[model samples]
Target: MSCTTAHAHELYQLYASHLIKRDIWDVKRSVMEQRFQFDPFAPQISCAGIHEHHKILDDLGDEMVVINQAYTRLWPAAQRDCTYLTSRRRVDDTDIYAVINYSVNHPDDHIPASFVRASAEVGMVCESVIRPQCTETSLDALTRQDIQTKIYYQAKISPGGWVPAAVVRETSKREYPKFLHQLGKGCTEHFSDRPLDCSTVKKAFESRPPPAE
Candidate 1:
């Protein structure tokens, strides 16, 4: 997990752009096409309280049609297409985001004979809270910088051909942490409103001790 001063909405926008915007895929050197079938926040819903916001999110669901092409060392280059159900919800002070493949098919979507059909599930939660700081003098007042958002992310993906589960597991173990570090650096840059030295951030995250098993 990582902490940032960015608000939940800012982080949500970042995540949404990465998934929905075509330019982001281009930056990653992947071919992607996305069409939105449904959008819960299309008109941008507004609510007065936290409970109302949560209820609106639960009631309205978003759906998208996607086609992606990529190459990986563990598998041959292939294209996959699928429809996904995407959602964002607020629970108390925490914001949750999720995307899962839907069984429904879009008439316009077709996979080539050489391509592999794949599916994935992703979820992330961000909690906003005041983090206490250690100081020489005993004080209770919290500074603006003390307010932080904590993020947790999880993803389950299948390449859908004959790829071994062991290979997938090992790949995730090596790649997921790197993804998190990049995300942390992104959040820090957004929060600070300035670009940070990549080497400094890399060293900081890499030097941290591993999580307890």
Candidate 2:
């Protein structure tokens, strides 16, 4: 299942539109603003490598697009929420991200602590299960030669972490201007273009229904 760059962007746009129609951005933005307490329009915001409010929304939208697009290219038998957001870091250099949570599909399947990191980041996202070493049996040790060979093989075929760069560029060209317009309009009307504290947003959402799938 190989997905072309064009198809991936199209899939992203479709899901992204669904999310916007449902006011997903508003829901997230309300909470995010409250938590971060940063002004989106401040020049200092850009200097910190943090995207302003609109860009954050676009990134989330972009991530959804990538996940769904990647799904179309995955083996049909592969069944799991491909979308994950990292949440915690453990002492062993293994980080934990949401295995699945807070989505309409697969409701009640909020399994955490499933995904584990084996080593440092590779340029691509790939997973393979390794059996735990047992005290009773000594495992054969391999040096740099063996590890290098494995890395070469895996990286050669991996998708290089996300959708192709060309797809991202094209998607932005088509979608970003409209997104920016909407964000500006929305902020002006609702927030007066100010960033809010997360506590307010969190309480507000506490009463509303959970975000859509």
Candidate 3:
């Protein structure tokens, strides 16, 4: 049989098992071509193909594992205390929320305010099976005017009761490196038949751990 668009959906396994499992979302993935042949898990980015493409995981048991793994790798980290300033919701009932933290360029200089904007877009996420109401979420708009930093919406996701997940920095003993390492391993040994998106890894922000004591 011809291997052209003729294979089962199989991912790189390494990306989700390590590196990108957690950092995938924040990372800015390049425009990935749809994996139509030889792989079933590839997404349909075009308007017409979107609805049908998103339904890749509807009833298939094998594909469900792929979506679940994607979900875990995509969740943001917990809030921190010492460096953390505050956390609040942007809107009611919606999965969108914002977390603010204090940081500085140098010790002498006062820490500038940093905020993380998060939301599950609702209709944009690609699935083996399409959900009724869904939109992809992504880093829609990131604005920085002098000191102001605003990250608008991007791709959407299912609102799986997603809330503001947080952990205070100073209070939290775990360091950034430690967290990054763990974050990379979002799915552990859970394997999937999905190709790895290099764009996703390239676009991720640099993870910085706190200074050594």
Candidate 4:
């Protein structure tokens, strides 16, 4: 398939947000901090260019905003844990981004830093999976092409490939933002702001008892 500049730009905007929330930056720091014996970097599934290319994607109208918000909501589906940080990297020319979930309870795990680094490399591919379907139900109507065009890249990042800009060609803030804006009773919008921020997004969620409750 062929990609266009518009779609590329939108993807870039969305990806910029993805890296932050996904802890890609933090993951990199963890590797560098540990030094050798604790070899830096995490293992990945593929060396797809998309992982690094996230910072750049088509600027397909306002589609980027929708995908960005979509990613944030679905992050927990695959992430599952709040304490661990994640990072992705390209494996040479292949289209893969090995995912690493760094152990956050370093003090409690009482494991050596080198061990932790080693463990992250092993956990890279297996633990990461499809975007949480339940969370991304709003995109239920998305076509296969749509999946590949918009969500596929970040959902399961890999390299040696590219998504054409035409995929999200029809998307726009006017059309897609409403989906994100409508979720959780607009809680993400906050009391004073026009859009969602870190503080208000999770405010509307109600804690629940377990199965026995």
Which candidate, 3 or 4, would have the higher TM-score against the true structure?
4
The candidate that wins on lDDT is 1
Task: Give the Cα-based TM-score of candidate 3 against the true structure.
Answer: 0.18
Model 4 per-residue lDDT tens digits across residues 1-213: 133455544333332432332322112212223332211322122111222212221122322211111112222122111223334443443333343433233332232222112222223321112222313322233222221111221121211112222222223213233332232223222222432222211211112122231
Candidate lDDT (C-alpha), each = 0.37, 0.24, 0.23, 0.26
lDDT of 3: 0.23
Worst 10 residues of 3 by lDDT: 46-55
Please list the residue runs of candidate 4 whose C-alpha ends up more than 4 Å from where it truly belongs after superposition.
Answer: 18-24, 27-213
TM-score to true structure, per model: 0.47, 0.21, 0.18, 0.19
For 36-72, candidate 2 gives per-residue lDDT tens digits of: 2221211110011111111111123222311311111
Where's the lowest-lDDT run of ten residues in candidate 1? Answer: 47-56
For residue 81, model 3's alpha carbon misses the true position, in angstroms, by: 29
Candidate 1, overall lDDT?
0.37
Off by over 4 Å in 1: 1-13, 16-75, 92-104, 134-144, 194-213
| Cα-based RMSD of candidate 3 | 24.1
Per lDDT, what order, best first? 1, 4, 2, 3
RMSD of 2: 24.3
Pairwise lDDT winner, candidates 2 and 3: 2
